[model samples]
Target: MFLIVEESGPWKVDAVKAGLTHSLADFRIVESRVSSVETEERIRLLVLGLLTKMSRVRPNNSASDGSSVDCEGHVGYEGEGEDVGRVGERRVNMGNKLSSKQKKKRKEKVASSLQIRNDFLTGRSLTTEREKCYDPRDRTLTFVNGDDDLDFLCEDFKSLRAKMSCGHAVTPMSLTNWCRRLLDQGECRFVCGQTDCHVEWPFEEVCKMALLTKEEMEYFEKTLFRNVAQDYLDVKVCPGCKSRVVRADLSELSVECTTCTAAKKRPYMFCWQCLREWRGPAPRSDRCENYGCINQPLETLRNCLHITFNDVRGVTGCPCIRACPTCGLLVEHNKTQCKNIICLRCKVEFCFVCLKLTEECLKSSTHFQACSTGVAPRQTSIPVWQRK
Candidate 1:
């Protein structure tokens, strides 16, 4: 067998090189002299690490060698044939001086791989060759061991996406292509953590609801969530039309333009059912499309088709979103409760007079008899009226 080794201390170098020739493949025993202080020294360390791993995979022969441990352990020779002085010599033996440069480059590659592994195990975002998978929320791609240092995979979520559905609360960049995968294998319901009120609610937005900020988004990186009943109200947001939500005055609603209720010409409220626009003070409490106030004392609010309701307490300013007509506030939907109308804002039924929700009529009162077109009293029971 051919024994190859660096010219090191005469005794150590010859013995190990000789032992390897007898017990291991002749081509396997290879070594070289590298000064401990030079860049080449690090290369030697890497090679040593590789050698240790390789030895484990292909065990050394014990019968030909002194002992199994001895074969695996150090076999440093220490005589004149072994050249210890070679360790201090510059690695200029290669005919070309540029050889050192090539060796240094190889060492750098090894360092980079070790670093990538480290970052992945610590839950930090690292880019691979194609996409960025690290978002502040429940991103796709199940990171191995919570190690996120993938630097070669993932892509632009929007570009790669194929389609989407409601209540997923998917971000603008979320991939649509994965929609099929998510729906087919969705293990948990995605929840929105906008506030404590929506503590456990579905994250999907309806009618173009706004998303949370970056900082707020980070708060739920690993949290699993779900929604219940009409819990969406807790996550509601007032779309700041033209960024004019704060300074607009709500008092002179009569003189204001329908599209320009607030200072910045923001539509005060949007009819969820018809998508009609409303200006000034919003309904005190009612489902957006259900209306009893349409014929109530307040003529200003009569145009709204929303169903009104009182809170659970049956008082004015009702929190109920569906099946209530006594409230002035309108909810966008009607799903979780009975169709009976209850008024919480005025603490009274539609027959009782409380004007909190009655600020939007063209005339003084919304009574059908008061209209220019004579009233025909039809006993049609609106859904909200039954809930009352």
Candidate 2:
């Protein structure tokens, strides 16, 4: 009988090989070289089980000599072997969503259950043919469950990710915008849909998801240093120095600076993910002290302190949008780019409230009545009705 390893547990190749020594004797032990995806998966599971069992059998934290024990593919406190468990076991992170097992069970339940389609809901199924869900406009899943089964679909199917830093709802269509705007928007809050545990997630977790989902990430995962005893999945952003010379490989430096080629180099170091220097003017806002900040370009002070989720946990209040101190106008507390906000009245560059240049005020056809004039503008000029 073919052996099947459980989710977290790996299989022992030696055991399997030994078991089949006489009986089909030629059975191949699973390895990384397995050509098929299915075969590779099976092999990984067996190895996981094998590695886990091996670690349990020998609880010693190190090789006998203990000159700083460096077990070939192991990590953790050398003296503390109990902490080490399965090899390369990916802990199910229930960040704003249920665990992977739970999600799989839910999907299985949906597949096995008798679903009554809700025709009016308007969408195709993700499991169905691609042409069905191909709606050019919204570019979303629309409806994964059959329209008739829409009502029957579990409410937990909503693993919808939101835009980074803005906290705006997102879909596959908005994925592009999410990556683009992440830097513009500082740490965002992603609220879970479970309703009961409507917890909010931090930006780091969001980036974690992004890096995990990255197309090139799989190739990178293969490059990671694996530990056969303790299981962990830590993804480091690809090393790219956004400065006078950007290095593509991340192995060059653990810390990097986020700066451009032209702008004045600011002292702010790059964040582990975004690679942007943390020079935001918002108070209590610190820096990402990664390496390579010396090459970055910033307009203001370079913040070099790192902030944890707990650091910003109780912190409430939107970041202060400051104005130029001299003009008594609204200023950007931390933004480095000079906007085109022009003060039509002051004739300098500023919107009445903030003495800052609007990056492009004239090109903006939107309404901006001077808040001071008390003249509400429908489009641009003060509204005739509100003027009185």
Candidate 3:
């Protein structure tokens, strides 16, 4: 006789026992009571039935923590934990493997912002490779039609064609000369010289378009820094080392040259007004001990030549060079443009004829017409010394 036992959740044990029986083969007969062939076949059939029922049972879907219950009422978790760990590892690896282009792009973004101190002291390049949208070396000029106008401010615009950001075609030589002219004229903003198209080109963009060399770029930056510094601060060139120095105390004319003092191993100072070695008292706003130590800038303001406007009439006794009312920086008029000129230093627009704010001047008369009050008397903040 054979005894067949059935249980509610004994499928796991039964499956393991069935596996052992198959592996042990004839040894299973010696380990237990010998049974008939029919009894052994019945046991095999019963184990198979239990395994089929367990395989068909579905895992519980109501578990909230990604855990499921099997037919044996035990908890088993999903593979999401392993997947999340793998994703975190991938993110960490990606952070350390940034490409060179990505790093360069990040650097360029920071360089684009204006830093006045950095620009004035160490200087900033107006031209960088990232700003070079149009390179003549790798690019050829494209003409829309045979009727393209090549009339730019530069005479050499016709030869060695290269298009600027403003859509005007210019040669490298011509672009260089034009930009240099603007800088020499104390123009901080580089505007397109093409007539009727006064699009302002960024400094970096201009550097690339002009194909400036290292020496040319340095010169441009230096000139730009000098122009900007002269507008806002009382800057003077050190007589000892010829390095540009800023006056810390505007009330005192004497300025110490740190560069020269460090080089000479002693204190070195210069007269701000005279641009010579400081010979007078420690801190005197007026003239130094040296004879004829007058303010040259003030003298220029008092004795500058009178200007005559080309288009506007009835303008007389207006100085060709006028001091900016705001910053007192000397600005020269081209005499070919309108009566009103913008001060490059202070960026204040005033009448070159009436010497009043553009808004106040325009209220009384048109740009081409004479000012309501003829030429205004020159206003100088510094008292001009009469020549003895």
| Candidate with best TM-score | 3
TM-score each candidate.
0.18, 0.18, 0.47
- Can you write out model 2's per-residue Cα lDDT over 1-388, one digit (the tens) per residue? 1112222223222222222122112222221110111124334543444223322221111223321211122223334433233446676655797888988997886554323121101122224411111111223223232222121233322223333333334332233233334322321223433336444544244333332223222322222111100111122332333222222332232233333222446443334334454433322212334344442212121322221122122222222342232232233423222222442112256432322244333344222322222211111111111110
* Stretches of model 3 off by over 4 angstroms after superposition: 1-163, 169-174, 213-233, 249-251, 263-266, 300-322, 331-348, 352-354, 365-388
Candidate with maximal lDDT: 3
- Local error of candidate 3 at 319, Å? 7.1
lDDT of 3 by residue, 45-100 (tens): 33433112211111212144445432223444554222221232221344756799
Ranking by lDDT: 3, 2, 1
RMSD in angstroms, candidate 3? 33.4
Report, for every candidate in turn, its global Cα lDDT versus the true structure. 0.27, 0.29, 0.56
**How displaced is residue 310 in candidate 2, in Å?**
46
Q: Candidate 2 vs candidate 3: which has greater lDDT?
A: 3
Worst ten-residue run, lDDT, model 3? 28-37
In candidate 3, which residue pairs get closer than 3 Å at backbone N, Cα or C atoms, i.e. clash?
126-204
